[model samples]
Each structure stands twice: as C-alpha cells, then as structure tokens.
Target: MPTKQEILDLHFMDARYKLIDLAAFLDRVDRHSGEGDFRFDALKAALPLLLSEQQGRAKAVLDALSDPSIEPIEKATTQGASGAPRPAGVPL
Candidate 1:
C-alpha cells in the first residue's frame, strides 16, 4: 500500500475540490425556499460518514443515500429516480 503522504500527494487536490463543490451545493440549497426535500435529507444523512474513522466510508455513504426498500412499486410516480429514496412518513 502507498504511504499516507503518498496517497495525499496523489489525490488531496481532487478531494479538496469535491469537498468544496459539495459545500457550494449545500449553500445553494440553503438559499432556496421551499418545503423540505427528501433527497436533501439523504445527502445530509450521508455527510457524517465523511468524518467517520471507519473503513468503507464510500460504501457507507452510498448506502446512506440508497433506496432501502426491497419491494418494487406497482406504478411509476414520476419519470425517473430522484437519485435517493425519500425518508418514510415524509411528504414529497
């Protein structure tokens, strides 16, 4: 495996850019006015994984945003997925 410094040297800038992008996206969302969004809730739910001292942070975060429902719906609600599942009991 590469040394910690080596890993940082190769990928830190890209990670920095992505972190900034995510921050900017959150900022933009906060500037808008509307009812709560479930997709945004998923994004918020996944943020803590970035700070976690655990392996598989990527998978954990992806799982956080994933649709946990096992059964398929009988009909289409919209044209396509909104990228993440809505939290249960929340209105759209």
Candidate 2:
C-alpha cells in the first residue's frame, strides 16, 4: 500500500480539480432561476459525507440519491434514471 503522503502527492491535483468542478457546478445552479431539483437536493444531502471521518461515504452518497422503493413501478416514464430517489410527488 502507498503511504498517505505518496497517495496525496499522486492524486491531489486530480482531487483538487474535482472539488473545484463541483463548486462551479453549484455556482451555475445558483445562477439559474428555478424551483428546487431533487438531483441537486441529493447532491447537497451527500455533501456532508465528504467531510465524514467514517468510511462508506461513497455508498452512503449513492444511497442518498437512490430510490428506496423496493417495488417496481408499473413502468418508467423516462428512458433514463433520474439519479435521485423518489419521484417529486411520491414520498420515500
């Protein structure tokens, strides 16, 4: 396994860019005029996980955005997943 310092040295810039990209994305969201979006809500809800000391952040984040429903809908309205849990009118 690589030392912590070695790992950071090799990946810090890539991580830095990702963080900046996330910030910029949020900024663009803020500049737009619109009601709340579930995707953004999911992203915001998962932000705290990045600061968490515990492991499983990735899984936790995925769970946050994933639909909790065990039952399948009669049919999907869209061809793609919304990337956020629960439909707008549906309760989790």
- CA lDDT of each candidate? 0.86, 0.86
**What CA root-mean-square deviation does each model show from the true structure?**
1.7, 2.2
Return the clash pairs for model 1, or none.
Answer: none
Q: What tens digits encode model 1's per-residue C-alpha lDDT throughout 19-66?
A: 999999999989989965788888888899999999999999888888
Judged by whole-model lDDT over C-alpha atoms, candidate 2 comes out at 0.86
Pairs that clash in candidate 2: none
TM-scores, in order shown? 0.87, 0.89
Write one digit per residue (lDDT tens) for candidate 2, span 1-92: 99999999999999999999999999999999978777788889899998999999889888888889887888777787888885558533
Once fitted onto the true fold, the runs of candidate 2 whose alpha carbons sit more than 4 angstroms away are 87-92
Number of colliding residue pairs in model 1: 0
The TM-score that candidate 2 achieves is: 0.89
Could you say which candidate leads in TM-score? 2
* 8 Cα displacement, candidate 1 (Å): 0.6
